[model samples]
Structure formats: C-alpha cells, structure tokens
Target: MSNRNIKVVRVTKDDYDQVCAITPPGQIYSGTDYLPDYFHMLLDMSNVEAYAAVVDGKFASFFLSFVVDNGRTVVTRAGRTNKEYAGMGLQDVMRRNTIKDRKYDKMAATSGAHVKAILDQIKSGKREKILMMEFRSYITSGDQLKSILNTIGNTTPSSAKPIDAIELGDILTNQQVSCHLFPESRVIVDWVPYRLIKSNAFLIKTIRTTVIGSNLENGTRILTFGNYFNTTAGLVCNIEVYGCIGETLAEHLYLHLRELISHEISGKVIIRCFYRQETKSNFITKLMNRFGLDITEIWGTGLVCTETTPEIYFR
Candidate 1:
C-alpha cells in the first residue's frame, strides 16, 4: 500500500461511459458488452453505496459497498483500469479496511461493487443482529465437477431433497426471517423465478465462447423473462430441466446452468444454503455435487462464513 493519493467518490450515470472505457475486458460480464440496466439498478439502488477511486487525477478503481438489513456488509467490483494500478493490492485493503469506516462487521460482498454499496448501509450498528455474511459464486458450464465432488465426498444425506422451486421465493415472505436476515438476500428471490428462469437463453447464446463441448444439443430462445414489480426478473437458461427428474435430473440441471452462468456471467458458481432442517439438497448444490459439478460452497446448516472458507472464498 503506497501513499498514493487515492480518493473515493460516488459514481453517477454520467461516469458510466468512463467506467466502461477503463474497466478491463475480463471484468465485464458477458452478454452485456457493457454494463446495462443491471448496472443502472446497482448504481441507483437505495441501499447501496457506490464510490469511484481517483489516483493521480484519473480513475484508479471503484468500490461498491452494500449493507444488508441485519448489519451484514458486502463489496463488489473493486476495479482498476491502469495496468500499474491493477496490481496495487487493493483487494485486501478494500476488504479489511475499505468499509471498516462503515458501521457494519461481518460483511458479505459480491462481484458487483455498485450492488455492494446498496447493501453496505444496512450493516450499520442499528442492524447489529447480523451474525454472518453470505456470498455466492455462480457455477459455470465448464467447471470441473469430478474434482469438486471428490473433495466434499458425499457428505450430503441421501434423503435430502432439492429445495422446492416454490420454496426459493417463499423465503422472502417469512417475516421472522426477514427481521433477522438482511434484505440483500432478497435479490436472489427478486431475480430467480420460473418465468425469468425461462428467458436466460439469450444470455446463454451471448456467452457461447465459454460453453464449448458442453454437450449442448440445442439452443432455445426466451420469449420473455417475467417481471417483478414491473421489472424483468427470471428466465430460462440454455438448459431445460424437462423430462428429467430426481437426483440425476438435479445434477444435470445445475451443471448445465452452471456452465451457462459461469461462462456467461461472473465467476464459478457455488451455493450457500441456510436452512432450518439443514440438509445439503439445494438445487444448485445437489445438482453440482451429484455429478461432481464444480467447486461448491454448500451449507446444509449453521452460520454462512463457517462454510465459505476452504469451500470457495476466492482469496
């Protein structure tokens, strides 16, 4: 950490062009040649705190902090366009100290910074009930499934069942859970739905470069992704779960979706499930691990952090 004069400023729609021009190609999500509506959503989110770092009168990097409802913290998209700054070791600084000034502890950051800022405020002392932070790594189509299963090694119980798709959304309506957990988790429920689940085919097509040899037999187009609160949410991925059932069905479904997502969206896919009964049959977990899908962080029970480590915490 050099004594470089680095300043952090909130980002606006106007800065979007500069951010896009500078952000490395690797940092950009596929299908979106540039940050689109989702970028706007993250930047304008009411709960997030967005900041751009300026070093030597130029954009060096940016950090997006998000506060969960119960004092959980998250950061996303700490990026630097300057090759000299790319290796400046900002991640550790940002992770351990960036949001320390923000009142929250036990932060849970994600891949999108702008999204993180919205989530950071909720982690304030007022929401100290938050004990753990949760993060997800979307599994992609090309992930090494055999290597992953070999590690976790059938820790899952046979009787465990995939979370009922309906249950995915129902988690939101629970007032008691909502009171204890940060509203940030709501994003999953907000975006994932049967209708929205049906339209992701376009995204899959957009990221074809990463899906070579995926056993993809056909390509399907999404007619429409259903809307929530009048905004698009879920849609179908390139893979369809039709004619498949039970564990094998779950495994293939997850593998296929993981390939499409990981290749197309962000990083590898891993699931963190927090449940009362606590069994490891989540749709993504079981599906991935069943076929040795890929690196996964499955939490059948207990706190979120305990499971993230050694499972899939990037660093």
Candidate 2:
C-alpha cells in the first residue's frame, strides 16, 4: 500500500492473465479482448519491452514499449493503472523506469494527455529528454456524417477532380502509407500491418474506398483503422483515422463511414482523428462540427522537446 513497498519489474508470460484482469474496460478501442492478444504478441517480439508495477506481488500498473526503426526509436504503445491504485503514481514509476532502461534516439507515445506527463517529469529532472516532446490530436464523432457533409458543402476544389478511390485493404497493404502520412521526424509506433488489421481485434467490418484527388496528389492521405464492439448500447464502433487529409477527403470518408454503420446498429459511431499540428486539428474540428459531431476529447497538444546531447535521465 505504501510507495516504498511497491516494485517495478519487467512483465512476463506468467503475468498475462493478471494484467488482463486489471485492464479497465473502454480504455482501448477494442476493449479488453484485445489486451491479452496484443501483449502476447508483444511478448514474442524481441523488439518489444513491457514493464509493470507490482505491490504485494500483484500487478498494479503496466506500460508497453516497442523498439522501432532498427533500434533508432522507441514508442510507448500503452499504459494504464488499476482503478484501485488510481492515485498511487504507478504510471510515473513504470514510465520513468522504462525510459531509464531503454536507450533510443527517438521516443513517442499516443496518450490522451499528449506527452505532458512525460514533459513534467523531464522538466522536474525526474527523467531525461531522450527526444523532443511532440503532441497530436485525437478526435471522436457524435452526429450523423451526412448532416456534417451538407454543412461543410463541397470541399473539393474545382481544379481537383475526384479519382476512383482505392480499397482500404490495398491502402493498408502499402508499406509507404506510414511515411506518407506522418511527419518525417516523428516516430510512429502504431502502424498496424495488413495481416494484423484483419484479425479479430481489428475486425474491420466495412472499409469504404480511400478518396484521392488530383490537386492533393502529394498531399495528405487518410488511413483508417478501427474495431466494433457489442456493448450495452448495441454495436458500437471506434474508427481511428490517421492523416492530414483535407476537408474534401475527410467529408468523403465520413460519408462512407456513415453509410456503413447506418443500419441495424443502435450504438454511436466514434471517429478518432490524430493530427500532428494545430492547423490540422482546427481543420478536423471544423469538419466534425459540420457533421454535428461534438468534440468529445482532444489529446496530444503537438509540442516537441528534445536534448541536443544524449544523456541518461534515470539510473
């Protein structure tokens, strides 16, 4: 119960069920069903590392990281603390320990709080700045997609004509998609391959075409990945779209999403968009408003901090 009594250790196969048991529902898009599978997969990978806080020999909090880009980068995939241990600061313990032990040129994480928690640790001298601090936005939807489209009105410019969109599957298979979507300096850790995308956790029911345009040929491309769940509300959807696709393509994607989930589902459609900059965030916010979707939450402020020289912050 006391901070001194708790221990932070590397997660092992024996800890799998315990971790799953403590993972709160709705913390992730696929919910609890995906937790075990995901951690198991990570456990098998040589590049992956996971840590947990154990109190009285029981798992209290955990964090997951992956060594990406051939040892040049590290990404914090996810972290959560048990509701029972909410105020214990277990997350800080695990995070600090992992960053101290893991050496990499760059680091990244997708968090609702952006990276502010980590920034605070760095500022207070609790942790070292291994990489620059960067924030991104995650947006979810509420209203009907069609109404939003009508409100936005014709997003496509007259000079740029719509081309036959590609299948979502094809886009997922393209390895270049990640590089095309994210900034060159940022290290992206959630680029799910096509094979994994088809799995149950990522059970993509309806993947509408990826709209393309002539004028925005070299511009942003929207890549969507999400899963559906049968909750108390019915078949709820969590669609995560990544990229800086402008208004026209955004409207097109939402139209397809609306059409796919319109029938036989009483649950709400939650569309999450991750933006690397404030301009893009504003752009997506406007689109969401037009569609009648309220801005449920915004995470990652798109700020980056870095250390000019490499040094260990934790020992």
Candidate 3:
C-alpha cells in the first residue's frame, strides 16, 4: 500500500538547495558534512543514487547510496531530514525504498545515538555489524594549541608526510598497514569506512584530502587521513588515525596536530579523531599526559556523538 502523503524519488542537482537546506539535527557522518560539497559529484556518477522523501509536495529527507568494494557493498550516507518533519518517519521511508532498489549488500555508517538506532533496526531485520570505532571530538583554539605545544618538548615529528594519490594508494596496500593499522582491512576516511583496497584509496583522491603516513618497514605503523572544511562552528578539522596503539599512536596524532598548528587554522577548531576501541583509553591517556590536550573531551551539545559507526548490510 502506497502512502498518498509521501513518496520516495531519486534526487538530482535541482534538489541540492532543498536537501542541503534541511538541517535536521546533529550531522550526517562527522566533522563538516561533505553532503553539501559532494552532492553534485555523487549525482553525476551513474552508479551512485541519492534519494529524497518528498512529503506533501516538499522534500522531507535525503539519503545517498554509493557502491564500493568491487560493488560488494553500498555505502549509504547523507542521511538527514527537516526538523519540521522530525516525527514523520520520512527518513525511514526513503531509506527502505532506496534499499529495495539496491541489489548488493548495504551499509549504514552512524555514530552516538544514531548508532543505537541503526543497531536497533538491524536487530529487527537483516543487518550485520561490519566495524566499530571510537570518535573523540574536542573544541580547541590557538590558545589551547599553545598550551599543549610545550608538552611535546623537543620531540621531532615522525616521517609522516603528505602523499599524493599514487603514494597513498601504495601505502594503504602495505601488508603491515593493512593488517595491523586497518581493522579487518578497512580504512576509515573522514569517518566513512572503505575496504583496504587501492581503488578506494584512489577514489578518496577526489575528496582532495591529505593522506599523511610514513612508509612501513618492519613493524612500523603510521597512517593519518585529514581534511578540514568551513562550518558555522568554525573550521572543522576532521581526521582519522590508523596506527599502532599507545605511545606510537599518540606520537602520530601529535604529528597531525603539529602540522595543523602550522596552517594557523583560524576560529574554534573542532578536532574530531576516529580510532579503534581498544586503543582509545591508552591512546588518549598518553596523548593528554604527553601533549597536555586530547580530543577525548565530551561534546557538550549541538553535535551528536556517534560512539560506534556500524555498517548494516541489507543483503
């Protein structure tokens, strides 16, 4: 039975303003929402599909699905709705319609309270937990960076440097980097998870991110993928870290922080870090103890703190 009040339809560039304008609450994934920036790019792709729930002749919610990992999975993102239509169930209606059209397995990446909602949905239906990672968001400023700068104390930065597309693709494929750094051979980029494959690495290049990591050599571990975007909350410094936990990981984090400081990133900086669960305590511990600051601080409000991002499969 079709509901006369609402209908799900594929979106296009013409729907950009309607979709991007709907700031329901919190954010889509994390950091600055790439939805507004990359929506057109997604629409241009033949394999990608973005759908919106038009309720009573108005765009109510938006969702995007992109095939990845040799078409084995469809990553669903850019999920949100208008606060005006909050209890209307537009998001669910749009998501269900979109999933029904997808032939491959589906994945939903969410955090904090949204993660629980996704998990709850999975329990009721057919969904699998692909991966789980911890996210720490800290509001920092230049003054704060100064306070922590002294704690590092004559520490030289690691060999971590910016790599081009080719180099990044190569580094991600390194056996050690893929096995140890990446959990289940999945690389988390800007909070979106992708398999440990060169193709995905190259795909990220379109996002124009700086892949910072060193060449692995005998137990060596280092990987930092970071990119910042303009937001009302100030410059959002979004990043993901994949490295050996504890001291080594802390050092790698500092390397990114130190590099960030040099750019003199203006305004309140929301430094969001995504890392594995087992390493969070020790990693943040050493980071604070060594650098006098950490992203482990509780997010007061405004943004939803997605504790675990689980990818639910439709197939």
Candidate 4:
C-alpha cells in the first residue's frame, strides 16, 4: 500500500473511457446501475465538479461535488472505488484532497452503506452540528408502472400542474417551501442536491427534469421532480417526492408515470421513486398491496455536516 501513489484530479473528457471502465460493485441494485452513461453529462453541468482517483495512472475511483444552495452548501456524492482497490484508503484520500480550498457553510453526502461511519463522527461531539436524514427509493419496471397507474387511475389531483422554469423558480424561493417542502433549504432532485433558487432552475432543466406541484396556497403541499436517462439495464426514470402522503403522493406518482404514456415513450422503462423519511409506511404498502404491484426498495442516509460540525468536519 505504501508503494501505491494515489492522485485525485479533476475529471476531463479524456478520462471518460477510463472512468467508465473502472468496475462498479457487482452487487445488483433492484435498479440499473452504470457509470459511463451519466459521466459525459456531468462534465458540462453547471457548478458541478467531478473528480477521479487515479492509482499510478488509471482512473481507479470517482467523486462528485455539487456547489448549490446559493454556493453555501457542497453536496458530495457518487463516490466509487474500483473493485480491485476496494479495501485500500483511496476514498478517504480522495475526500480530503478534493475539498481543499473550497469553502462552504456545510458539506452533505448521501450514503447507502457509509451512514454509520458518518454517524460515528457525529457521536464524538455535539450532535446538532452533524445532522442525519433518511430517504428511500423504489424501482419498478414499465409493466408495474402500467399496473399501478391503471389501478390508481383517475385518483390524482386535477390541479397538479407541470411548472415551467419561471414558476419553478418562484416555488423554490418561497420561504414556506424552504421550511415545509424541503427541510434545511436543501432541494435534491432525483438523487442530486440542488438549491431551490431560480437560477438553479435551469440546471435541472438541462437534465430534462420536470417539476410538478399541487395545493400551492401559502406553500406547496405536494411536489415532485423527475427525469429519465439511458442506462445499461434500459431507460431509467427517477423521481423525488416531498411533502405529501396517501392519495396526494399517489397523485404525484401518477403524474410522473403518465409522462411515458403522454410522450408516447415505448420501451422497457425502469421507474425509481425517491421519497423523504417522513412519508408514511402505509402509503407505500397501500400503493403496492392494494394494487398488487410490487416495488423494490433501497435506503439512503443524508449526512449534512453543518459549518459548526467539528468532528465530522471536512475542510
């Protein structure tokens, strides 16, 4: 291990093939997983920086930093190490090196397996500095998609409207939205963290995400954002649900799924719905059980290390 020199560098177009070649964990998610399909777009995304962990000369791992929440927050995610170098400390080195010089009020990471490590850091000191939030996702195919939508057909809010760039900006900037819809003023669409600001609106649009909302009196009561992309398994549609449960959640879920039919998109489509921790368990049970549709789930933890979080500190 001492002889191996690991260098972390900014990802470039030249690293595309190598980064894609790095073998991802063989563990299958109920959903599709691939690196290459998304790397190309990340290179040109606004305020997003992607890094590669190179062992000697090969791209052995990758990390991404998203500067959002009006530049006060840094969202770090998509960290991966090749199977060949799994046990080595390349990930720690990459985390430490990539954060140098960049300043932020806090750094947040979404983890499926490393949540406990982040929790350990929080336990070492005051817990308020380091915060934890849980999110869950369920992935289903086009057949299930059709079944659920058909079963729950005509049951969604008639007012759920797909907002354009301008309206999306308005919703994100609303104080009520920050407090209720998105906790801690952090807005994550699909799996990426993004600010709710109007300017940040175009960023999600670049990825072709559509924002839909209902019950917008003082603030939105139910909101959902999503987009789809090609993957090794087929086309994957990703949705993030916030501030709604029961029939309302189902309504938004229906709206998102209707995209395939409305657009006349035909293929083997995989739908992955990401929802907040607060969503009631019965909602999911009913959504599937009542309709006899099955949904495969994955759990994730959101570690928000605030500016004052000392033990879990980064930079």
Candidate 5:
C-alpha cells in the first residue's frame, strides 16, 4: 500500500489475467468497457507495448500503446487503475513511463482525463503540437431518431453485407479525403489491426447499410455498431456510427439503424459518434439538436510531435 512499494513493470503474457482482474468493471474510464479477451489480444501483439503498476507483485494499473499508420504514430489504446489503488497516480506513472520509450513520430489518445494529462506533458516542454480536440455526440430516443430520419428525407438503402478489410480500408480512405476537403469534417483516429477486427466486431452487434449519393456516384456506406445492456438507468443502447457520409446521410443512416435494432432499443438509445475535431463538432451537434437528442461531449486531444514529419495516412 505504500508509495515506495509500487513499481511499474513491462506487462508480459503472464500478466494478462492479473491485469484483467484488476481492471474496473463496466465503463472503466471515459465510457470504455473493460474487455478481458481484448486485453489478452493486446498482450500478444508484437507491436503493442504494455505496462503495469504493481504493488508487492500485484497489479494496480495498466497502460497499452501500439504502432498505428504503419509506425508513423503510437496510440494509447486504454489505461485503467484499480479503484483500490486510487489516488496513487498509478495511471499517470504508467503513461509517463510507457510513452518515454516511444519510437514513433506522433502520439495520440482519445480519453478525457488521459487527453488532459497528455496535454500537460506537452505544456511542460515535451516536443508536441496540439493537433485537435476530439468530441463525441450521444443521442438516446425514438422520437429524436424519427425526427432525424424525417429531416434527412428519402434515402435508398443498400443490402446488408459484411465489409471486408479491403472495403473497410477503402471507406476509411474516402473518409480521409472528406476530412481534407471539408472544413466541417470530423476526423477519427483508428489504428486497429485487421486480425483483431473480426473478434471485436462480434461484441459490437453491428448493422451495416449504404446511403445512396452520400459520397460520389458510388455512394457511401454506414456501419453502426453497439449493444444494449440493462443498467440502473434502464436498458440503454450505445451505438457508434462510422463512415464519412455528410450530415444528412448520417441522419438517414441512423433511421435505418433504428429500424434494424428497434427490438433492442428500450429505455434509451445512446448513439455515439467517433472522436471529431472541434471545428466539425457543429455539424454533429446541429444534427443531434434537430433530432431533440441530448448531447454529451467526450473531450479528447491529439498532438503531432515527430522529429521528422510523416505523411498523413488513414488507419
């Protein structure tokens, strides 16, 4: 329990179970669910570097970072501290130590306190530039879903089909193009490996649909992924939409989402958009407002700090 007894060590395959055992259950930090199996996968990844704060050989906190954009960036995937170890600053210690070994050009993260912590490091003279502040929009209601649907007007729905890595990669590329061209576009940083996608996809219970004319003559596709769980607040549906479709099509896609998952929507439907720059926040905020869905902003920040600037690429 003493501060001097705590030590930060590189996490190994042997530490997987202990790490998960100490991870706080449900919404561990910034709405991120603690997935033990996923944690195991991260531990096994050659590109991922993980660290843990241990006291007397017991896990207290953990942090994970992995190469993204083909080694151009290192992203902090998740960090959590055991409630029993609260107030010890274990999370900060793990983050500091893990990042000190960074071999990549840029570092990125997408959690509230963690983002602020990274910013503090930059402010303290770490070579870094604030790329953007990221935010998410949460919507929960059938009425609002309907309103958004009506606002978007008629949209042709494409057949439901599973998106392969190739198609997903193309969609992400288009997303990057949209981000560069549109002043109001929101960009999300995703660096997940192809091998891990299949396993994680199962937990999301996703619904995929295409919106005609949202992009070019080929149109755009929307992938809405989430799950419903019973909580004290009631049965809540948390959904995340991916694709670079414009605001109108984004709303229309949500309508199709409601149709596909109506049985799962119970007390509330919490829809979350990927992390977007502050400049593009208005596009999503306005859409959610028009639909009467309450909005909560999940704040995150990104910094570009590489010795040699690397070419930007979507991951």
Candidate 6:
C-alpha cells in the first residue's frame, strides 16, 4: 500500500528536483549534501548503481548505491519524495537497502579487476570483521531515542579483542596535499594493485598527533584538521580524531570541527569519525544516545559523524 511512484534507478541530472523533494534544503544543515552530491557523484563515478522503489511510475523513493574505498565497502542511502517514508511505523524505506547487500557485493566483485584486487587485499588484512557506520537524524525525542538506541548499539565483531585495547591518535598534516584529476582522485588503495589508477589518488598529508597519554581513558580529546583536494566529488576536506573518550567529547569536537571547516570551506564538508577497533563499552552506547550517529548494523564498525568531510584515505 505505497502511495506515489516508487522506482529505484540510477539518478540522472534531470532528476534533481524529484530527488531534492526528499532531501533537505541546500543549506549544509544536518547531512543533506551527502545524498544530493552522492547522486551526482555516483553518476560521475560510473561505479555507482542506484535502485529505487518506483510506485505509479514516478520516483517516490530512491537509494543511492556506491562502492567506495575501491570496493572494500558498499554504501547506500535511501530517501523518498515525501518525508513520510522515514516516519515512525513506516521505516520500510530504510529497510529496503538491506535487501540489496548481496547484489551490490556481487556487482562490485564482477565489475572490474580493481574490485577483485581490493578484495584480495582485504582478505590479506589481519582485521577479521567489517565495520559499518550510519549517521542519521534522531527521529524521536532523547528519552525515547535512548531507549531504542540502547537496544541497538554500535556495530562490533563477534570474535575480536574489545575496543579498549586499541590505541587512538589524531592525524593532521600541514604538508601540501595533492589533488588528482577529477574522477581519478577517487582511486583507492585497494584498487592500486589492480591498476585502477597509476597510484592511490588520495593525497596523504603527513599529520602530527600530540600524544596526550598512553592510557585509554574517557575524557581525552584529539582534534585533527587539514585541507581538501579536488576529486570526482567536490572539494574534499577532512577533520578526524581518535582517542578513548566519551560521546560528549566526540560531539564537542565534531561541533567545533564542523564550524571550523565550514567557515574555511564555502562548499559542503563531509566529516567522518573513525574508531580503531570494536568496543562493546557502554561508552559507545552513551555516544549513540547523545549524538545522532547510528551503528549501521550491516557492517560491524563504529562510525560517527559531524557536518565535516575528512579526506578519504583509501589506505
């Protein structure tokens, strides 16, 4: 009993208005740019394949599909022409993405040698689990959301050492970052071995992290920031920090970083927070409770976000 058209397909430039209907305003508020640009970039990358739920032949709802970091990871985002799709009791739109997991994996595997090579590299890595992070808005009030979130904590692996053991560091480099030609910049480390690009296009800036202490504690803070590079996507910028801290510090750092990057870069910034290892710590649950970050249950990774875009380091 779906109203309006629901068709999932590769988006075209012409579909801007329809897609915008579901997306937030142009203001870089919340995580709007992630999807709109994601659509265009998908088309540009040609590595992206979209699927929509077309009802009545109109684009009622759509999900953006892309394999990033050379095919080592698959990311999909869904939105509807009307906001109803994301409302309570009607979260089916969010659920639709889970159905295509295997399909996308197979697609990435069969697409090109680059993906194959990336897979081989991942297979060789010592890490044993996949990590998935989802940054989304909090639909319900804090109390209710807390109840729901506590039930679903950050994604973690079943058979790995806990998050407490891993060391965390914030990396920032003042070195001149290199920018590859458009599109080529999207080349990832995993794709390097397969000849995807001459080499990893992501410009690595040698960043220095001020080692605060060796102990993994909850109150420590690490702040990282650097310049952006022109890639297939818009001017890419990154600000990241990793330390054993609570959600308050994470949110505080995220907020300050977002303001910092936004003031500096007129364009949109996609900020990403990466945790080193899995943590079943109540700290993760507390972070989820405070911030809107969601643990994408699909891949077992701890990912949080702010209105910031960190340079994508494929390696």
Best by TM-score: 4
Regions of model 5 farther than 4 Å from truth? 1-47, 83-103, 113-116, 133-136, 141-155, 158-164, 168-187, 190-213, 216-247, 255-267, 274-286, 289-292, 296-315
Model 4 Cα lDDT, one tens digit per residue, 1-315: 678987778888788777767764234233355455566777777777888888988888887777766777666756777888888877667666656666676666544434566556556642333333444344455665677667666664677878787887887788766567777666667555665677877766655577888786644387778787666555667776777554666666566667754543444565555566565655665664443334544434332443332135632
Off by over 4 Å in 4: 25-31, 125-140, 143-157, 194-196, 218-220, 230-235, 260-270, 288-292, 298-315
Against the hidden true structure, what lDDT does model 3 obtain? 0.63
The lowest-lDDT stretch of 10 consecutive residues in candidate 3 is 300-309
lDDT-sorted candidate list, best first: 4, 3, 5, 2, 1, 6
The lDDT, on a scale of 0 to 1, for candidate 1 is 0.36
Candidate 2 clashing pairs? 132-305, 133-303, 133-304, 133-305, 134-303, 135-302, 135-303, 148-290, 148-291
List the candidates' TM-scores in order: 0.39, 0.53, 0.75, 0.78, 0.56, 0.36
Write candidate 2's Cα lDDT for 180-231 as tens digits: 6433423322322112121212222223222333233345555444343343
lDDT string for model 5 (199-261, tens) is 322212222222222333233534533334433333333333444535544445455355535
Q: Which residue pairs in model 3 clash with each other?
A: 111-306, 112-306, 112-307
10 residues in a row with least lDDT, candidate 5 = 306-315
How far does residue 221 in candidate 1 sit from its true spot (Å)? 27
| TM-score of structure candidate 5 | 0.56
**Regarding TM-score, does 2 or 3 come out ahead?**
3
Q: Candidate 2: where are CA atoms >4 Å away?
A: 1-17, 20-23, 26-46, 83-103, 110-116, 122-184, 187-245, 255-266, 278-283, 289-292, 298-310
What candidate 6 gets wrong by more than 4 Å, as runs, is: 2-5, 26-32, 37-39, 68-73, 77-81, 85-129, 132-238, 241-315
Model 1 C-alpha lDDT per residue in residues 1-315, reported as the tens digit of each score: 467876666778778766655665443433222233345655665555656667776776655554443433353333444466786755444444445455543444322223433334334321222223232323333235434544544453322233222432332344443323223322222122111222222222221211112111222201111111101211213222221123434433333333433333333333332222222345535554555444433221222121121112323
How many pairs in model 3 have backbone atoms within 3 A of each other, for residues 3 or more apart or on separate chains, i.e. clashes? 3
Please give the distance, in angstroms, between residue 288's alpha carbon in candidate 5 and its true position after superposition: 3.4
| Candidate 1: residue 9 lDDT (0-100) | 64
